[model samples]
Target: MCVSCAWGKPAKPHPLEFCENGAKATSWEVTNRRADRAFFAAHTLTELETWPDHDLEEQGRLTHPMRWDAETDKYVPVNWQDAFEEIGRELRAMPPEKVDFYTSGRASLETAYMYQLFARIFGSNHLPDSSNMCHESTSVALPESIGASIGTAILSDFQNCDCIFYLAQNVGTSSPRMLHDLQDAVSRGVKIVTFNPLHEPGLQHFVNPQMPGQMLTGKDTPISSEYYQVKNGGDIAALFGVCKALIEADDALKASGTSKVAGTDAIPDDPSDAGTVAFAAAMAAADKKHVLDHDFIRQHTAGFEEFAAAARKYDWAELERVSGLTRAQMQQAASTYANSNAVLMVYGMGLTQHVMGVQNVHMVVNLALLRGNIGKPGANICAVRGHSNVQGQRTVGITEKPGLVPLDKLATLYQFQPPEWIGHTTVETCKAILQGEARAFVSLGGNFLRAIPETVAMENAWRNLRLTVQIATKLNRSHVIHGEIAYVLPCLGRIEIDEQATGPQAVSVESSVAHFHGSRGRAKPASPELLSEPAIIAGMARATLTKGVVPWDRWVDDYSTIRDAIEQTYPETFKDFNKRMFHPGGIPRPLPARERKWVTRNGKANFITPDRLFPEFSLGAQSDDVLHLATLRSNDQFNTTIYGFSDRYRGVEGTRRVVFVNTADIARLGFSNGEAVDLVTAIDPETERRVSGFTIMAYDLPEGCCCAYYPEANPLFPLDHHDTKAKTPSYKLLPVRLVRSGVAPAH
Candidate 1:
């Protein structure tokens, strides 16, 4: 069972706790493996470096502190004191800004807070983190539209919504727990509409492995009521098309004298509507049953007029061509959503990991605002995060670019002058390293080398660094890509308990829905030699900083003191952090939107509109014989960490070198199923930007779109190609030409 599943409740056991995906996560974490000094001794650094990612991880878990010996190019065992002292000396010598503190979602909140505090105390704001790569776009865009950066809806809202609009995300494979919610919603007659390029099986049918009957019979549970395979990067066009259809539908209703606009409440406190007649008058502006949240639009937001004008100016026909969805499908989704009492819209990396990722998020927010779906139960926007504690990491200050509140509060709480300037984000950090501006890199968790785009370049940058420290659970690619002085410190995994000078420590985590909960580990420590993240950080801070520079030892010995410090900093949110976290389910932070209290400067929810319908990046000229490849994971994969190679739903066998291309595209390109081909990306003409020797497989995907596994094809992605506003790599839109290995051009 997953850690959050059946283990949480005693009486009412969750039926989907033991799903195949959860089993994979658990097995991978609690594997019977140990990669100690002996294992490292057996294999030379060069030999280990030559091994594939899976083979190295499968070798075993690390059991001792290891330091890279540059002479031998191997990791030699060292005492914890020597490793910490060496790292401390490096940090003490360099300017704080020269060193970047990076963290992964797997790190504990205590560790994350301490890491940020230590960096600030040491006089650097360089805290490039994993979030910058994935959901930084969401964090950047959502705050502008809504008062908060997080999703407006909670998980419980799923049970109350009448209709659910799911876009771009494959919930079954990415988050198996989400399927249970979808199935529950379907059973309650919640009309589910899915927009994706391929028909995901989880959106079709999901059989709970925990359900004895379903598991034995192999019967599947239904998920979506209707599914539409929109073209890649076509979400914006589809949204505009649906909104246009909605406008048309409203006009038709008005002509028939059956419009609901007549009875709805007034557009609260809209001065633009001042001296204007009624709610019907404002409704008449759009000729729709619901207009945008006028009060929310006017005060707390900007660019309403521009957004409304763009919505009014968009043409259905143009949207249809761009989206590749029929006018009927667009009309159906719009009408279904408009008529439903409460509708919830959900999106994931599919929409966010684009060059126009922020704009894409704004469009989704625009759709929700038009129907007044936000700030109400069962009707809001949901951004499904990839990492387990990603939301919590952001909450606890694992950020390179800190917000005004976080920086200001941190300065006051820690008694240090925090840097006013925005630090380097993930993309910026990579650029800094390449430019020789950043010298050292410290990662709390996550394989930075494998996770980031432009793999070869990032590795080269890592090699140039002065020192690289990785506090990890097991060996990954990042460990082998050593700097001049590299240290690999094994830390306790999420499933393992952290025992310190005080007692068992508890860490807090914020879920996707903005609910904060306590995550206490029950499993034993992987090894006695391993140190908790907090202790490791505390030791480093003590070694680097002079005495009384900060209270590092006090917080490290007792983690509750850290929570108390967090409470002091964010009193409103975490008034009684320690006491409240003691509750079975930690308290939900106060979101102004939850109570319809907008915290914007205008103190109202605002409608923000962009001058353009979609960003320029989304609109591109179609290249002949070139397919836009979107890299994705199979049911067996999790981010960059692959559990196995078998994708059961795709019906693929033991290999990741398979490409999912449409049959028509295959015919047009003159490629057959299982034909070996080179998918050359249209990125860097000088360099060979192609993933060679991939078996072409025909799948039920849309035309002008193809699919392949990531990190493998990540080489094809250019380093500079990213979202202009958010800097998230456009993994979804890689224009490339496919060719047979030895065959000449058809021309």
Candidate 2:
């Protein structure tokens, strides 16, 4: 997290220009062009559905509470009291299982805490959130592997690392702020190796604007020392290949008289040669030292024998076929890891958005474990979060599974018995709504309709809801796709001033690095009608839970009370919340794995063994015709918010409907560059899912892999295509065929 995600005082705030389209939206939101009660009344659901997502949002900030009028086929203004009372009545009319409480990642810690608390008090555990879509695999696998849900390394590890394994992260488009960290690390002689389907410019080099010299000279610093385009969903195989190579090299070295390979067959086997300048120079000339941290592995880890045997059993041919990379490339990566003092394996959605998402993370941890990299200063798994405060939301107990959190402490402190059973995930929520089991859908913030898969199917099922509530700052696709009786309550954005009963209040956000810092909005609210997220939640809680024991109003008045309660609930992690929150850099939660202390059932980091070497998609799609689609995001996009039609990084200038494929695949599939193609998935003959009119652009990707932008390509994803362990939607792994769109390409 950067300045926007923390408590900081800059002459000018970071959100103004650095946070993608945040600054531009902030400027337009304060203008008179916004959606009021009248705007809603004038528009019908059919009309709103026709509006582009950008235009729907450009209708500006939602200035009043609105409810859908079935008779008029429009949303009419409703006062906060009536809206809250109506929502409460509807909720009370049905069992807690009928409602789904969903939250976006951008909400503050206080708001998330109260939101989850309200759901539990209302006797519902169905709290599906954005994390369920993105990094839920990390949440599921990390604890099993290392006994922690967070990455082992913090921010400082980047600077101290000797090498970094960059996997599937397109830094330029997604998070440019991280480019500075990568730039700093690379400039210090740290070797960065990247593995991705697309050759992202951020992974290649970066021209830091913050550094005046580089900007003045228009020079870019080279980043990755080597790059490998591993096939989609083949990251586990790629990593396994490297691990096998490392193990074999070490075995051969110790088995023979070779102490250090040093790139020569006649090298000496002296033990004292490790530190000598001549020997060190000779070692530096080679790719690897052919050594392993056996002591660290034996003392602090478990299941090594089983894991290694599984990895070694897979021959080079199978690994090469699955990974779509040469054996030499994997060996080179292993050599870099072997020679490095500390290696950081950084991965993004490329690894997590798969059928084997949890196993993908497990393999990354296993790779680090092979060399005893975890719990060290500059080495470990770095599961980069897509959003800023997503981890924080989960940290404050926003989860469907009650066992994943400290619910016992919460029940003890709040004096309310929460549901113990696991609730619906995102996919389950969609299914429940389709089957008429889910009566209502409540979202704190985010464009849930546009972000989810099977847009058409969900749009049809959305109307089945008895009620839908959107607590948001602006209009979105979700707002327009209204339930039978819908309410849109405007809330203050992060940049807006949140004036509370006491005074202007601040809310703390926990960054991905586990650092907790307060965020106080300084800009004026887009409208005077706007309410803070805490205030809106408090209103919902007050109206719903009349006999509630918790003091919602008091907490809303001063958020420090919420923080105080949070500290009491999570005494170990959030101890002295208020005091440490506004402190200089913020307090960090103590992760057990950070100190080589695994909090697993066996009290040691376990090497997870997969029953198979490759993912189901890779195994099933053996031929080049059944191409695997890895959905991507445009450079001009932030989640579902499309800022512009241009994606300068990917070389697309004026359109979002385009697909990139390798020349070999384009030819093999009987398609050519600039050909309009319809990418369709045939799960069954009766059902056809197609994203039509996509122009084919030839790019460097694996033969069986093609790239298309997300949300647009979301329809091709099967609803059931998800990680079994985490239930995370496998956005990356999709088998689709290409057919001529029979439409002319836009010139």
Candidate 3:
């Protein structure tokens, strides 16, 4: 319901009206791709490891529990009891600190609750999930700034918002349904301002495929009212420019007091005028409104004076240089923000996957707070998430820090001391595994190895592990890249029935828009051999834990009891879990921020002052020869899963191996428009990484910035290149050099 960018409640009537992007691709998954007991017996792990991502997943749904057979070099089928027994024995032999439990966004709230409970009771708080890779910045920043990790806007907020500031999200490939929201907003005359290195086509124009007349007549609806190509990793400076312009306009409005004569925001009429003069003349034509919410600042906020003073200190020239946008452009964008009664600040991974990811979110929240946007009808921060249930997983206790969780309640419930030590995140998990500190890896579905950076080194480290266990629905690269004692345990998919002792059971999933949805599988199970994710975790917990404090068998039989347990752990959020959330359109999980109740340390919304004008490695620090490489998802991809080889929005048809660069950069670097080249990163000279033979395509991004599809380009960046506070990798602004295909490497 969440990740594919579909509405929390999907549209209907016409097939094209289904706003979920991955629906059609997901429907193609039938028995044809099923990897039965025989399929596992047929292919060796080595043979499967050689296959590409698209080809590998096409092998179909995994049918049974299979253990790595070193003697035969193939996966051999094993019974459930024996498999759990073996895994439990190995885990029991090692310290719990040496085991890492990672989860994907696909798991349900019930499953995630059970998974983390098991990890905590086992004397380790080492729980990390898909949130670490994507919105960890949001998870960390929002709470510190506004007292809630989740954003304040609901799905309906899009309908009410007067203006939308859409930043760095390529909705064409990532979430097509979000375009429907923008289109609906546009139909209502809402102003949409977009900022990104490459201005995607969907943000420019869209002819609805559902409306035959529009498609046949070639009548298109424009989405973005104004588009700005903000440089990669330059969002903070760009935001500063807009903030500077807005504060200056407010200062002028306060000084003038409705008398508009030579004010800071006003301009005189001039005949035969240039574009800047025309814009100024248009602004001078109307009476200006005070931009900042003075009353809201006085009553509900702290640190405004300090934040405003810092904004006033920034020079226009420096903002122009760092943000790659002129003062005029910044003022125009700021004018749009100030004029609108309500503005929704929207952002995506382009803002998060950076060294200043947390700061980037803080700035977005600060901008929203300046105009009193939080807790309003159509004004708030919207951190668009990537995977389906990723946010929900975090809501149910999948995290590296256990301090955020109610430790005393859990300890009393289980009658055991909970592990309070900070856990290893995705980046630390890899380092621990490489250093031989972590011996076991348990994942709740995800192509972890392929999706991470430093693919070669990670794969080698993965193979050296003592044990690796994957609870999944389908075959992927992780299944093939087996550890010494790897076990692939097949589980029920979200689309299949998960029957238990309490009749057909439904698992609750939290959507990105704060809705708690009950996802029930109508279809039959993929195979009789498949077990539910909660059942699998329960089985492992029963075999491993000697105290047997939890009723693992009963929890597996009745998932509703699991919900009750979750409510007990997180009473404020998950209270009345069974009664409130299991219906047609699920009830919204309460957002304290939406009510203007800041749960921060000082009990007021805090306006943070960023220490530096330019975040992370600034534009001037790197040479012109170096380019910022951003990894992205194609049209046919969902997260790390590739459905096909097509990205129709950008005109790619048969290949995924391509790099997008500025048209001038190709000439500046002595390369043709479509020439093949090797991407090399010499950031870490000792561990210089390279990916060879990628076709170069001239695109509309700024110079010194390049783009490439993910997974294929994952190896180009090192493991240590990440945001320190959030631990999110710098996938968006990796500095690299494009050399000719046959040239020698940098290091």
Top candidate (lDDT): 3
Winner of 1 and 2 under TM-score: 2
Kindly report which residue stretches of model 3 are placed more than 4 angstroms away from their true locations once superposed: 1-7, 10-17, 28-31, 257-285, 615-622, 745-747
- How many Å off is the CA of 527 in candidate 1? 1.6
lDDT of 3 at 662: 94
Estimate TM-scores for all models: 0.91, 0.93, 0.94
What residue pairs clash in candidate 1, if any at all?
A: 35-60, 35-61, 296-605, 296-606, 297-606, 297-607
| Candidate 2 global Cα RMSD | 4.7
Across residues 1-747, which tens digit of lDDT does each residue of candidate 1 receive? 133221121123374355666677777877778988778777777778788887878766678999988777788899998888999999999988888888877666667778888887777778888778777888888877777777777776888899999998888788777787888888898999899999889889888766779989998878888888988888888887776555444434444354544322222222232222232344455455443344444434455555555655666677777687887788777767766767898998888888778888888887777667787889888888877677777777767665644777776666677776678888888888888889899888888888787777778788899999999878889999888899999887767888877988888767677766676778877788988888889888888875334677788778899888888777887878888775643577788776766666666555555445444422225557767788888887777777778888888889998889999999997778889997776545555566788999999988989999877888778777778888988888777778887544332
| Regions of candidate 1 where Cα sits further than 4 Å from its true position | 1-16, 255-305, 601-604, 610-622, 684-686, 742-747
lDDT of 1 at 326: 84
lDDT of 2: 0.80
lDDT of 2 by residue, 374-429 (tens): 98889977777766578789989899999877878777777888889899999899
Q: Provide the lDDT at 455 for model 3.
A: 86
lDDT by residue for model 3 (1-747), tens? 433542455323236555435674456344456887788788888888888988878878888999989998888899999999999999899899999999988889999989998898887788878788888988889988999997777877888899999988887777777777888899999999998888798889988877789989999899999998888888888898788766666654444453332223332122222433343334445654456777787778888777777777787788887778888888899888878888998889998988788888888887887889888888887888877788888888898898888889888888888889999888899889778788899999899997777788988888888999999877899989977899999998777788988889888887778888877787788789889999999999988877537878898889889999999888888778898776655768888899899999999999987777554543244466788888988878888888889888888889999999998989988889989999988577676589998999998888778999998999987888888899898888788888888786543
